[model samples]
Target chain A: MTTIQLPPLPRVAPALTCDPAAISACGADLLAASAQVDDLGTFVAGRARVDDWTGEAATAYHQAIAPTGRRADAMSLALRGVAHRVEEHSAEMQRLLDRRTALEDRQQHLAQQVAHLRAEVATTTEEGAAELQADCDRVAGQVQAYETDLDTWVSDLATEESEMSQAFTRVLGADDVDRIYGGVADPADGPLRDKPGAGASPAEVHAWWAALTAAQRRAVIAAAPGAIGNLDGIPASARHAANTVALGRDLADYAHTEDAGVLTDDERTCYDNALAADEARREIEGRHDPVTGEPIVAQIYIYDPAAFDGDGAVAISAGDLDTADNVAVVVPGFGTDGESAPYQADRAATLYESTRVLDPSATNASLFWIGYDAPDNAPWDEGYDGAGVVTESMAAAGGERLADTIDGLRASREDDPAHLTAIGHSYGSTTTGHGAHDHGLGVDDVVFVGSPGVGGDTDHASDTGVDPDHVWAGSNSRDPIADLGNHGWVHGETVFGAGLGDDPAEDDFGAHRFQAESTTRGGAYSFGDHSKYFDHDTESLANISHIVNGDYDAVQEAEHLHDPFLGPVEDPEYDREPTSPTTSSLTP
Target chain B: MEVVPVSVGEASRAWDEQHLDLDAAATQIADADTSGFTTHVRGAATRFLAQWQRHAEGLGTVSEQRADGLRTTIADYVTSDEATRGDLVALLTYTQEVR
Candidate 1:
């Protein structure tokens, strides 16, 4: 007989005397009360009622029902997000259990086959018995494989089980379950609300979150998981659990739209972007660091995928960002999304491991933040608006989002705020540069890897608002992309907003230079080469890790002179060049 | 029980190939993978593959922890998500286009 466990259902607040309809009724009652007060005030105003009973404040008093009126909509979003998430968790748990049961059933079937073979072997002739024994041997292995499968299934189930437990009230005593279901009397005192600045600052969110009881917190999560998950200062686990719920709903909607077969082109794009975001979440969760044996701390700090004309923004962390002692956020250059995100995450894991190698005891979280829509990945258009297409304007546009992400991370940080470093690769370096140069993101260090250029007007490391000393750059001497930045710097600022400053690798650029491997083919590195600054065996990767850990002295210096006269070092493996600036209209 | 030595480079390539195939085959599963007993099997398979990917990678960095990790991957793979019952076979048809 197999043990069959049903999926844990959503916690039923037995005392939820307020279903959505009931909540609306309550709001309606409040509205009615307010109107009655208004009527009395009107009578007083007209002097048609009692003396001195002027209803001067009656109309204003009636406005007290506004929050109640708004609560219905807010509660709906919350309930839907929670219910969908609970359903996902339940479905996953049940699946794991069922799969395990299937394996066990297979195991039993094989075991019975082996048993039958053994019985036949006892009764059969020598030749038949030998064949029967061989059958038994094969069947025996199947039984063991099934047994092993079951063992692992149980272990994996624990992870889902634990997540579900947090999502629901698994550890609660019967009395506590009754009380949890009974629910809190006044949700107004709860942490969720749409106040003037409900999530304006991490400190405020922290304070509000701290004031709630466990049950209240659970209730708030159930009602508004997305708001809570997106909220600053909440713990990583809570946010992940909450966001998972929101994501499930979004995915379901996406699936539904697809099923309906009426998705607009825009909706199709949104679906792909949403799918990418979902995959990114999965990446951060079970993956391990390339260097460290520790479980990767995947946190979805921000997941606004449908923002900015279908180019969504997302931030994923490899470790707990809120509590870590050191954090580095990598903004990918171009063509980054759920699909391209694994590469960026791979870079983060590499950097994370390198940091540990640099400082054995450092608690770190490296984030792959594709939090802004970069230039679209496509060939240049008909007219190459040198300034408009793939210009620093894209970075300039993305500056605020980058700033907000850092600000949110900063706000959510625990006591003794983490030493944070922001690094940008390829075009992302410009975005990072501008985020500092323009938006004033507070970071301990800023590193530019394979940068196309900083802004046209911006000169020197200090321009990025990072301490000039902490400004860092790494570009392979043979890297053509870095070379393009050198050309723009050498060409002088061409288009006002489009132009980028001098090459940070140059001695004149004033950035502390680091070595990068230019060994893809010969000594020269091209566009494809530009993408591998964090690849294994590259000195650039080690230097980046050192910078993140604040081990400045350990950072390696560059090799090979970058004089314009240095010319092409050798034939590149994949010598792809950017289109001429005059005719170019590309975004990637 | 039939263990394929999860060589990191090969496994990484496997992951990329699997994703590309899944990207192409998603519609078939997305239509029917929403509910029913099959969904449970799919979810288990999906999660197990996640664990398996992790376990395969762990073989390099933390081979000592192999037993625990491999157990998860093997089980999940048994009930893993597929476009059809022959998802793995279909995946085999797609070659690794790039590294």
Candidate 2:
């Protein structure tokens, strides 16, 4: 009982002329045309079929055509009639051939048009892809050009900013600063924001960051965070950061050589001498210790040529710069010995010189480069030169020699015993720590730069083994050696000591350490490489000067702090303060 | 913790009594007669010890509180003496057979 159903035909597009009246009219015409074409086709086909079917009749008609006279007359008529029928059939076959040819031509023409259209579409698609590729390349070129331009612009802006900072700092010192800026110079002048620079005194610069536009202030804040507190007009945090940036920018600019506001002649002389003394070049003599009977060496360089020159003048506060009130000692690292190059001596001398140059005054400040051991190529030289030899035996010997050296200096300058600073770089720092540990040496500050180990910490006073309340460190990210060497060795108790609460080093390690800001992290000095603390023009020199002079604020302001290692200390006891300070005392 | 302490007077007396005899022994050190060496050494030691003793005298009221500083100075002098003696011994030993 299953019913069969026919599939419906696919719907066709609405008839081209679908209006009822037009459709009816066109239908009659279409039917008539179709009928005519069909009738012509049928007639041609039927004639061809009949001709093929009746070959005998065709022969008979051909025969009769030639037959009789009265029969000839009749034959003539019959022949004529037969000829006419043959002519009619021939004409119909011609018509059918013509129609078939037209239909074939139309189909060929349509296929050709379709092929041409496809070729055009392919060409257009290829062109579009090529255009897109060209656009991408152009964009990349523009990006690279922009990057280069930005770099150049930033470099130029840095230079300009430094100059502006110096100029503004000078303006801050003027007696009638308000009057000068009230309506004078350029259009940048106006009422001070929140009465800034209005009550400024002429004695010394009091952190008076000059008036800056909002954008300029934002740039400063971006450079050094938390520098300037918010002024009346600006947010407190943003302003504070900007001010800090301005201070660095200003001081850094003020110290620049090409800048307009650099130190004057007399001022330059003071700074030069101090820098020279700080980097004083001299021969360090190692001899048998009178006490330990061991070979001991003492650094015999003068911190100041003034100590040698009687006519030298000393000032306390030159211009906006202030001399350090305290003193510091900087011990040179490994490879520092009498045989070290003359540049070594220059580097040591330059440290004192740069500090004096920055401060240009004498407020009980001095620095020393302790070249206690002969220079060796490696920190691990086997026979009396390496760390192993030093730790096992030379340390005690150096300690004795150091004690004697300290005693000699004390005797020579008994008048000023209170303000002394000691700085140590690399292995020299270890030597300084030994001196402090074994002799109970008295110093205002002990600073270590590029130190491998000093066996002490500033934060854990008990574990420090040295008693100096202020211990500073300067390890710049630029110094590769700071991260090199045996990191796993328990550096005494603390993995690393507490920094002087300032950032001079740019790495995270710098945050936990102290740094010298006035000088750039990696200055263009020739001696900016490993163990080049005494190198001339390097920030290490400035750092040494600051430490010995007890410029705590300056060191803190450098903004070079960071902390790379954050894991909790493994052995806290090593960093814990000792129960009694005197217990670990090496004296009696 | 209960280590016996040496008084400055006692230490000084012990050094004084043994001073001459020690000088004799210094001459006979390392199986050699260093008589000439002993005289110079004794002279230097005398001057150094005398200065040290003078300094020690200035440190008054010896007790645990004050003794540490004085003791450190004394120990330092003793260490110095020992070191100097060690140096002299090494040099003297080298020169003994030649003499």
Going through the candidates in order, state the TM-score of chain A alone for each one.
0.64, 0.35
Alpha-carbon DockQ of candidate 1? 0.01
Q: What tens digits encode model 1's per-residue C-alpha lDDT throughout B12-99? A: 3433322222222222222322222232233542342243223222222221222223234433443555334453343332322231
Worst 10 residues of 2 chain A by lDDT: A313-322
* Candidate 2 C-alpha lDDT tens digits along B1-99: 111123332323322222222222122111221121113122332332233222222111111212233234334434454445544343332221110
**Cα error of candidate 1 at position B52, Å:** 32
Give all candidates' CA lDDT scores: 0.55, 0.34
**Residue-wise lDDT of candidate 1 within A1-588, one digit each (tens)?**
222211111121111111222222222222222222222222223322122212432223224323322332232222223233445654565566567557656765665665566466556775565455566566656665666676667677656545643432321232332234333233533455532274367666776676778766654554455567666667666676555545544554456546655456776877786787767666665566444565677777666657666666666778877677889999887666444666666677667766765676788888888777676455453222223335676787777678877776776665668999999887788788889988887799999988777666567787888888999988765667776664412544565444455667766567888766544534444566777687755577778888898889988765322445556422221342311111011122
| Clash-forming residue pairs, model 1 | A13-A181, A78-A223, A276-A338, A380-A585, A380-A586, B45-B79, B45-B80
Model 2 / residue A411 / CA error / Å: 3.1
lDDT for each residue of candidate 2 in A234-315, tens digit (9 for 90 to 100)? 3323432333323222222223322324345643544454443222222111222222333222222222212112212111
Per-residue lDDT of A451 in model 1: 78
Q: What does candidate 2 score in Cα RMSD to the true structure?
A: 52.1
Candidate whose DockQ is highest: 1
- Interface RMSD of candidate 2? 69.6
